[model samples]
Target: MRAFDPFGWLEKYFSANTLHLLIRAVAVVVILAFLIHRISLYSRYLFKPLWAAETLIFVIFLISYIIRINPADRSRGVREILIPLAGAMLPFALIFSPSQNLITGQTNYAYIVFIWMTVSTALTVWGLWTLRRSFSITVEARELVTGGPYRFIRHPVYLGEMLSAAAVTIFRFSPVNVLILFLFVAIQLFRSKMEEEKLGHVLPGYIDFAAKAFWFWPGPPKHQR
Candidate 1:
């Protein structure tokens, strides 16, 4: 049997309007990334404003992530960049070999958002619960946490952030929304990974911890092939 053409439904929306939306969406994502990088660069100097804005934004992201528990967040820096780029590319691509199902009035990929939201939220709570004491943005961090979610996944909070951000994009199902979300995911992912590398290098038993926990998804380490 031939492989199913999952993206075949995009045949119906091959118009100029969709193309324009896609181009604009791509532009928006690029702008967001540039702005975020600049903001992060000087956020320390403008701590109050940056912190306030990101806190509110992340809180909203957290709430959305928690709403869904089964779906999983597959966000990483690559995914963060790809999602918006994909949204932008979708219009042109769909014109020839489409993937979305327009007749249903729903994108074929919406289910992924649902799954990711639930998974991300669960991981976030778990990570927070595990590292209750070490949960500060202070430079000299407190003692390492090896409890709750931390015991299972090394970076549950990051996972949650990625998941939630991606979920929001999928739910909105718009070019602009997806683009903004992609940039947020990319920046946070970079920040988290850098922290993880630094912290893992310092904290004792980190080598063992690294050996055990998965980087993104929260669970027992998968068996090596």
Candidate 2:
């Protein structure tokens, strides 16, 4: 009789597809749990401006990532995965950082903070809305999205995230905070490059789509023009 090996049994029982499905299910559960926590935390400030926008972005994220087409090409390398993960976690640094008051001329910071956060959050929400089912953190290609802000720029989500990071950095201004913000933006841009490469490889039209708009700035998509 052959000796039983637990690892062999696990491998035999868990096919790659099954393992992937299980991992994704676990990820969804964790994300939903976090979303619930965030909602509970923010519920107290429901009357506050941009209240729904705060959670809406994350909800859209969960939806897009969960209910999406399988990737034609995906980066499963540890570096690729960690890059986006690091970028995502960088903004959380602001949660513990101390904020400083800034008095610019006669304007109070409340208006500035409100306007800045609102605009940035709106941009993020708009991008997420456009992405709907295609947006993801990892570098992968699903369906191409060319509507909404994608018509304006290649990566509105990253721009919005950077803007949000900037606002938070400003709120808690410090040398270390600024460094973290810059690092976050750099990672985002790097991830965009990887995404562009992967998309262009998997989707033939991505080249033309990229040409339609600048990587960071606004321009018309080819179909629109």
TM-score of each: 0.44, 0.82
Residue-level error in angstroms, candidate 1, position 174? 2.2
Candidate 1 residue pairs in backbone clash: 7-98, 7-99, 68-118, 69-118, 71-115, 71-116, 72-115, 72-116
In model 1, the runs with Cα more than 4 Å from the true position are 1-116, 137-140, 216-225
Number of colliding residue pairs in each model: 8, 0
After superposing candidate 2 on the true structure, give the runs of residues whose Cα lies further than 4 Å from its correct spot. Answer: 1-13, 43-47, 103-107, 217-225
Candidate with top lDDT is 2
Write down the worst ten-residue block by lDDT for model 1: 67-76
Clashing pairs in 2: none
Q: Top model by TM-score, which number?
A: 2
Residue 56, candidate 2: Cα error in Å is: 0.4
